[model samples]
Target: MYWSVDEVDATPYFSKTMSRNRFQIIWKFLHYNDNANLDVNDKMYKVRPVLDYIVEKFKQMYQPDKNICIDEGMMLWRGRLSFRVYNPQKPVKYGIKSYILCDSATGYCFNMRPYFGEGSSLPDTMFSLLDRLSGHGYTLYMDNFYNSVALCERLLEAQTNVCGTLRKNRGEPQVIRDLVKTDLGIGDKVVRHNDKVMVVAWQDKRLVKMVTTCHQDGMQKVDVWQKGHKDKVAQFKPECVVAYKSHMNGVDKLDQNISYYPFIRRSLNWSKKFVAYLFQMCMFNAYILYRARNPGGCNTLLKFICSVVKSWTLKVHERKGSELGEQVEEEEGAGVEDGDLEDVKHTLRAPYNTDPESRLDGDLGRHKLCYLKPTSKKLRPTKRCRVCIRRGTRRETKMMCKVCCVPLHAGQCYIDYHTTVRYSVSVQG
Candidate 1:
């Protein structure tokens, strides 16, 4: 992630021209330590806690506005899984589907559900997701996939209002679904209401159908002023369209933010995409919280990500520098005329020998050792690089990520050794 701040591809960031220790250790830790427990049979078990943790954090950190929205997001993953969906309409034609619930005003995700495909119904999932944040008089803006007359009535009973575009065939009387163009024209609408729920259809290009329990059958008058003409034309629109236009795209906004250089490492694991999605949600939520307090601080998502990455990388360097200083101090104190102590130069075998957080322990998940160590060290040096020698700069270099047939500089020539993102170095070895 730090490298992504300055470099585009992973190869350029972790070049074979550099010592492979740092790159291999980081790569291994990033992939293997997810802080989750997973069973072989459960598809979502790997990322369930990740998503739950992010959502719970968002809920605790921010109080959403009165309006909320529900939408679907499909990530681009063609991995082997039982419930991988294929929706040609989505940006990713084949991947897992997530039903996202976000705050309409702030675009903060409150909850999400990954489709596991074993007897999971659409309405049931939507209701369960909304159940997390009900009773707040928060109005929901949803799409036809999760909307029906029956469901809206149920939500109304819980004091939550629902406004969404609905399918004509789902829970609608045959008389209403079979309306003709002669009965309704441009700027015309019809409504069917019971005690709590209402279904309205307004004519735009075609008939736009919406079901709601939170809104009234009100028409709003808007003035259409032609640019060249001075006359103000009066047009009428349904309250559903106006409200839908205002609040229904929160989930879309979240998806757009996540697609910006996401931290999804390429892996065969299907749950990697889900975990990456959760992490993306966490970052986006954090950005939202930041913006809520400082409105003008970070203008866009990309800018927020850049600032976060740079600050974190700087902190890591500062911490490492302190540790290095402490190590040097200890080495200097080794031969303090105590007569029992050995010489400092003999004890200081390596500059990097220090305490690291990467140690295996009883926690069992993230306990793997992550420190980097070289396998062999050549006692004697060889000739300088011929190019540098010709250039009168005699720079000597030697190291390799894999088994080496030729000596090469580990820094500048990193791009020369590994031309691809694939790494042959093993962190464990």
Candidate 2:
């Protein structure tokens, strides 16, 4: 059905007419899962083709700005999947986790990797992400999970600067952690570093720790609305902490943009769920590009989404074929008396009103011949066979006419039954 957003929203027709079937009966993926173990990640599954295609398009569609961010995001999935990750901090606590590399300023996602049970090589991912922006002097901001001394070093080697909160276990100097416990006043921060990178032990409310390959001992003053003072007092903070706070939400901001008008649907298949998320991401990235080029263009993303949906729903050619106003008025009420009514009646099909026996089995319908397997061997219905009815025998059979929804004897009986109505060939042969 051609679906306009207005029509879909105006009336809840799908639930009423189509029984709200979420999937087609014959739907099959081009790729199949070749996994020997159902417990591990199935990367070669059918959705892999579509997933690769979508991710490639997402990366090629946009060039991220100088300030990029590395972050992990969760696309919600409650299905019974082995690789589902639970991060308590995210807006969605339970989901499939993915690493996202995004533009800090514009929230344009350039690349992503799905987490598949393994604690994936974050440092390797960081270097690979900046490889796309090599020689561009981009700065990447991240949270503690993806941030490490090795990651920062690798990013620096790739000519991309890094800044983010770091865990104490990432092999930073012991003194750095000790400095935070010292009697440092509010807004006072200490830094220890060699020639390449700096680790800052900063104290504001409690102790805040950050590691960076991009900054010196420089400090910037900013107002903390809730954390610092009730009046939003300005306090000195290290430049690394300042930049990390400013740019850490690049992926999250993109999430916010797409999430406000999400297209996620409950699906049993993992690939289908991922594809829905990818579609949402693509539409949102397009919106971001649209606004950047046309600043004076539109209002909210919801309005834009509705317009796109409605546009796709419209058939331009069909509308253009419509007659002119003068022609329409001249032809109106000029048809034969019962012609339109007869045509409408002919077009509509009601189960009882329409002749069931005269109806063709359809061009695509299948009919086959097989031994009427015993009830103990097969799942087909066992009934007093229709084929034996004419022969005056009440022998039961396990075969059934699928289309006509009736049980019949197998073999020539099945062939004769379908050939009597309409079927292109004997499928069982």
Candidate 3:
């Protein structure tokens, strides 16, 4: 639609701001890590840097309320990937699956980890995601996928509370499991409890099983539209059920917010699509933080994103103008006669420093390692290694990063220069 010629489908703003070819070029080069430095054991190494950075930023920017929830989120990807999951229940049925921990009230994501495979146990994954919140008095709500009797007991030991729908086979009390088999009428419920856990089997339209470490066996009245009733009528529900219903939609809310104006697009590379999904998540998180700071601010997510885009686009235009002016001046200076420049002592400017993050982005441009050309009539060409010079050591190498134009030693030094934010080396004697 952005490139549509039809009057109804055309979005002039996208075309005016950036041409389709420019957008495609940017998309094609969008990357977060050097392919050469990827860890073979880690499936998400291609986008691990951005993924970890965003997750850490998400946690640091905000503290979630006591009432938080855990749920699965899906990033739509049709491309082939080893860990892609399929679930008809999710809005994006087939995609990469992620376990997300979110604030129940505001739907702010606290932490998220993409599912790798069967190698990671459920308990281990849960504990890893809740590492920061464990030992705090937070109440975590989840579905059957994560809630289990043993897990609830473990969380209670960690001083955290758990409440969610439970599967029959997930170590539920035998009494509760038997109760699930029993036939019951509307609003009928059976409850069983120990010192640390409570299990409930309630029959409304169907049998609902739940386990909780925080809620009681008490019932709460809620409005429900029955089969024969013209208007809604009051129905007795377990307190746990009511609480679960209220808080379990945190991940869902996050998904809904990003779904409206998603940054993700069709891509042959699943990692690219995943990175775009992460970017969308970061934008939503920023919106959440913005709203929190300025409660009275009326800027919606779309408006906030548009304002950001406008500011960035203006900066780009300014940068282009400055670069063009510099080029013109350089051309005029080159045309000056040698006698005219002889009176002026010109100091060579330092090399322009490129962003380190951009260096690691694995862009499509040629970035191969090649031998430096000899400046003098020497048999072998050698330049000071960029990594070694930074380490207070004077080491030279013939090999250099072709795109960066900076010499670096082969193997570890080359990988470190592209992969690490800070490359360290011990000075040799």
Candidate 4:
């Protein structure tokens, strides 16, 4: 979802045609139903209203502030169909993408851009977002991906201060103090990794450079005498000539946060897929809230309650049947016959009932096909099955599936199902 300052003020009421709450409910539904997708006509009225409300509320919360942080994440979709406007990435092969601008100072979200593929196009995408900001004097803290001379110059031109990681071999480092060439040790040295700052100079312009002015935030230079003439602590404090490296060295951690989710469903022009994303987000939000509220409480209990309530609320009515009953005519307009009547009775299968003649008989040379089982089965059962024995009644005993923990019969318990459910319970229960 996206919101602008002007849109926040206008506060448009979501039309009644949108059935589900646009902000919370639709996404919540999409979130929990792993197999479900969102369509374009999916009820978005409910979510739109809530989103409208949230924007209004946030505006009130930050009435005088307009500072925002800009970033983008791609939501991948892997399906047979896709939108002409939003094409999938060649390598990624599927999924939509979205860029979000959040308020860094106050954790409030402000803008979103749903697209097909931009996750891999970081530099260009960041430039586009900066253009949107349009000369706003905002302090944009970014990672190494946005750490380039060209990007920094563009941001500086736009009056935006980009404080991000420095490329390893691209620019000069910021020097706080100087070191004697002879005193410098070869290779690397052992030092305690703690919250301590070191004064080092940019050795190679090709190795370390910044687009910022060299003008002083503040600069101090201390005279250095022979090493034995000075205090040993001073050597470490004023001139700890450590190797200069980028601040954001943990690329793996950052990469993990830049993956796909449901928000990009609309990029594919599929409302069902998008709704599924929103639903998942809401569920994730709910789970986090519940965990925060009740540290040791049963997540299964909470989830079960939600499922029951959702099932009860969503009506699944069966249509009444009135077309031809068991009566059968011998031929077109001819009188009905006993044989034809029996055949008609056989054809009229009732709901929740199976045809009795479809069953196989062993006397007809048919038996359950028995194939040799593999020496090992990969799936395991879940711990919720154990609850069956403890509860003694099936009423409150819905076991988590061993594979997906999406609730399954306990009789077909496998090792794979067991481990999968146990892990899910531990991480998400």
What TM-scores do the predictions have? 0.69, 0.67, 0.71, 0.31
On TM-score, the stronger of 1 and 2 is 1
Q: Give per-residue CA lDDT, model 3, range 1-429, as digits (tens).
A: 374343222486566457899998987888879987879889899999989999999999999989999899998877678888899998789989999999999889999999978587888888888978999899999999888999999989999999999987888877778764347877888888889998889997679999999887799999988789899998889999999999988998899999999888777988888888988888888889989998877478877887667776767667756664543333223323344332211211222333333457755244457665433355466768878888878999977665454568988778778776777654232
lDDT of 4: 0.36
In the range 1-429, model 2's lDDT, one tens digit per residue, is 895555535555333233334325434432333344443345525456667787788777788877888888889988887788888989999888888888888788788777776655767666666556766788888888887787777678778788889888786777875564556877777778877778888888878889998887888889777754569867778888888888888998988888887777776777767777888888878888788888887566776676676566444424533422322232223331233334323322232223235224543244332333333344443566554664556788755443333346666666556555433233344
lDDT of 1 by residue, 1-429 (tens): 354444323454333223588766755555433545557666666665666667677667877788999998887788777788899887879988888889888778888777778686776787777865676788999988888888887788778999999887888656679886677889888888888888888887688888888778999877776568789987787888788888998998888888885988777766655677677888899899898899989998878876786576566657756665543343232223333123322333223322122121224232211112222243333434422343356576543112111233554343323332222332223
Candidate 1: minimum summed lDDT over ten consecutive residues — where?
366-375
Candidate 2 residue 117 Cα shift, in angstroms, is: 2.1
Candidate 4 has a TM-score of 0.31
Candidate 3 regions exceeding 4 Å error are 1-20, 180-182, 228-230, 320-429
Candidate 1 yields a Cα-based lDDT of 0.67
Clashes of each: 3, 1, 0, 45
Determine which window of 10 residues in candidate 3 has minimal summed lDDT: 342-351
Q: Which wins on TM-score, candidate 1 or candidate 4?
A: 1
State the TM-score for model 1: 0.69
- Per-residue lDDT tens digits for candidate 4, residues 1-429, read 884442212334123122346745755544322224544443333244344454344334332123444544433555544331343433344554455444453333333445532244665666554444556666555544455545666666767655443454433232311232333443212221112111133332112222232122232344435446754222222112211112222222222322332223343335455544444434433443455568776465345335533444333211113222311221112222344435434444333222233222213222111111122231232223332332343432223321121232334232323333332232222
State which candidate, 2 or 4, has the greater TM-score.
2
Candidate 1 deviation (Cα RMSD): 13.5
Residue pairs whose backbone atoms clash in candidate 2: 31-46
